[model samples]
Target: MNDLGFTDEEIERYARHITLPQVGGIGQRKLINSKVLVIGAGGLGSPLLLYLAAAGVGTIGIIDDDKVELSNLQRQIIHTNDNIKIHKTDSAKKAILDINPNVNVITYKERFSFKNAEDIVSKFDIVADGSDNFGTRFLANDVCYLKNKTLVSAAILRFEGQISSYSAHKGSNCCYRCLWPEPPPKGLIASCGEAGVFGALAGSIGSIQAIEVLKEILGIGHSLNNYLVIFDTLSSEMRKVKINKDNNCKLCGSKPTITSITNHKDYR
Candidate 1:
């Protein structure tokens, strides 16, 4: 058994994790006591959820109102054809528990919005945004800033993807709003369903997102703090660009303005 009450099976299963110098017995315990909330159960969420659970994150909360569809299986590796029509959260929970029953899976079968975002996010230590829409992404960022929680955000489209982390603890780092003060005009953005993302693109970015979360929880390694890491799957190239916290950022600005989590009308 591990330091955090992991069973013999868990020890064997997570042996790879425990053996790492950066993540030894102490890190394993941290993971066992850590609580991470994932904001979606689709594409990006699939790999993030599976790896986090398999790594033995003590408590995992999945917030998604979507159901598994046959088409989703093409990129969403967690769900299966047999799970079509099943709630995405339910399907993810089953898959995670099947891999490691030690994990505690919490499901929010409703969409995350300004109304419930605070409450849902407050219950976990770290928040990972795998939601596809801008509204939910902004809501998650605002809630994370308000709760002073570490937020690991990632987005995948076509052959490109980006990942970053925002936290007050990281010393004046930028939040999602700092990068995109406003969502792209509607029709300017297209979902994977329409634009078509390479299957491995989401996997690559999502897995990096999971690593960011693990590093945050274990308090180890350099994270994508105050910078955005962009991956181009087609060219097999990656770039990191520095990002500064806007002095007038709505969320984390010096003059600080946005006091409430109000829905941005433009998102609709």
Candidate 2:
């Protein structure tokens, strides 16, 4: 093995990454040793998992209960037509291995729930949230915050997408609740089924989310912790705005009200 402990095959596979002055042998080794848990295998999860696996993240855990549907194929590019009806985790695992067999993939064909969330989340070094609904989004964010794991969260609807990374473990920065105190009302909630997301928007936002996760693991470049990136495909405009951790933010605030996961009611 090389000094970085990379096998001959691994060295060749990650040559592009190792060539960068910003990410030499050390950063490549860091990437090969990182463990990341991605919350969904849908649109956003598709590109996130693909990129991370190709980047040589040593271990990746994917959780998704749904089966591959015809509707999912358009944006969830990780699954193929032959894999339709298969569990998303299984299909995703297959796709990730296809990209990089050296990267170990752990799959959970289950939904994120109070009983299992903490246990599942604690197993990974970081979490990338690509869940579609508000309930899962809030649940993932809250659990990551409570578990003190770095969280890279992203969402897309229609032609727009947004992403942010959060870590209350380091210092006072924004958690998902800081940007959104709680899930929206049932009547106000929107879905891709209703609003319709651009097919490419998921790739655009999810790919960046992958970058955020790598940056967090490598401790390179600026972190997106207190920043939110908004992308508008229709207008071809992108905006990055600063946010803050609400002292009253039920979850990570100074006077925190959401001391436990159950306290933040899931409106879904």
Candidate 3:
């Protein structure tokens, strides 16, 4: 084993990470000890999962109810044409294992629902949201906020994408709901399916999400908490804007109206 209890194989696999001053043997150990959950196995989830696995994150939990589709190959690089009919969770688990045998992957072939969110989110040290829908995204944020887990959230559409980390439990840091009190009107927003997204754009945002997850695990550098990163690949513009927590935020605020997953008591 290496000085940090890493096996000789692990040390060799993560040689670069172990040599970095910010993420030396100590940080590498933290990563191995970390259990991270990734929501969705398409688009943003693809690159994030691959990178996390390659980074040697020991335990990874992936939840995805859908099956891979021919269209998904455009951006979901974790899966190949052979996995078109397979469940996303299964496809992702296979890819992750192929990249890093040391990683223990847990595959859940189901969507993230209130019934399962708590049990799943509670087990992981950190959560990453790569889901495409507002419902799933909001659910993840609320659950993470309530469970006091750090959340790395991101979304992509057309040539633009946004990313942010939330840990309202840390105080001053904003939860996803803190910035978006509620989901936008259904018709007002167009999903990747409806509006179409640039495949590589998803990679950009998902990579950022993966970087944030690693930072949270290593506790290095300034986090994305309370900062919203917006990227417009079309214009090649990137902006980092501050997000202030809403005092009346239903989930993470001075007085939270969302305490339980079920029955969602809206005190507002």
Stronger candidate by TM-score (1 vs 3): 3
Candidate 1, superposed: residue stretches over 4 Å from native: 1-6
**Global lDDT of each model?**
0.88, 0.90, 0.90
CA deviation > 4 Å runs, candidate 2: none
After TM-score superposition, the amount by which residue 22's alpha carbon in candidate 3 deviates from its true location, in angstroms, is 0.4
Q: Estimate the overall C-alpha local distance difference test score of candidate 2.
A: 0.90
Quantify how close model 1 is to the true structure by its C-alpha RMSD in Å. 1.5
Clashing pairs in 1: none
Instruction: Record all residue pairs in model 2 with backbone atoms less than 3 Å apart, i.e. clashing.
Output: none
Candidate 3 lDDT tens digits, 30-144: 9999999999999999999999999989999999999999999999999999999999998899999888989999989987888899999999999999988888888888888
CA RMSD (A), model 2: 1.2
Where does the lowest 10-residue lDDT sum fall in candidate 2?
Answer: 259-268
- Please provide TM-scores, in order, for all candidate models, with all chains considered together: 0.95, 0.97, 0.97
lDDT of 2 by residue, 1-268 (tens): 2876788898899999899988889999999889999999999999999999999999999999999999888899999999999999999999999999998999998988777899999999999999889888888888888899989999999999999999976787889888888788885967898878888899999899999999998999999989999999989999999998788887888888666667346724
Can you write out model 1's per-residue Cα lDDT over 114-217, one digit (the tens) per residue?
77888888899999999888888888887788889999999999999999999954577888888898788888889887999888887889999999999999
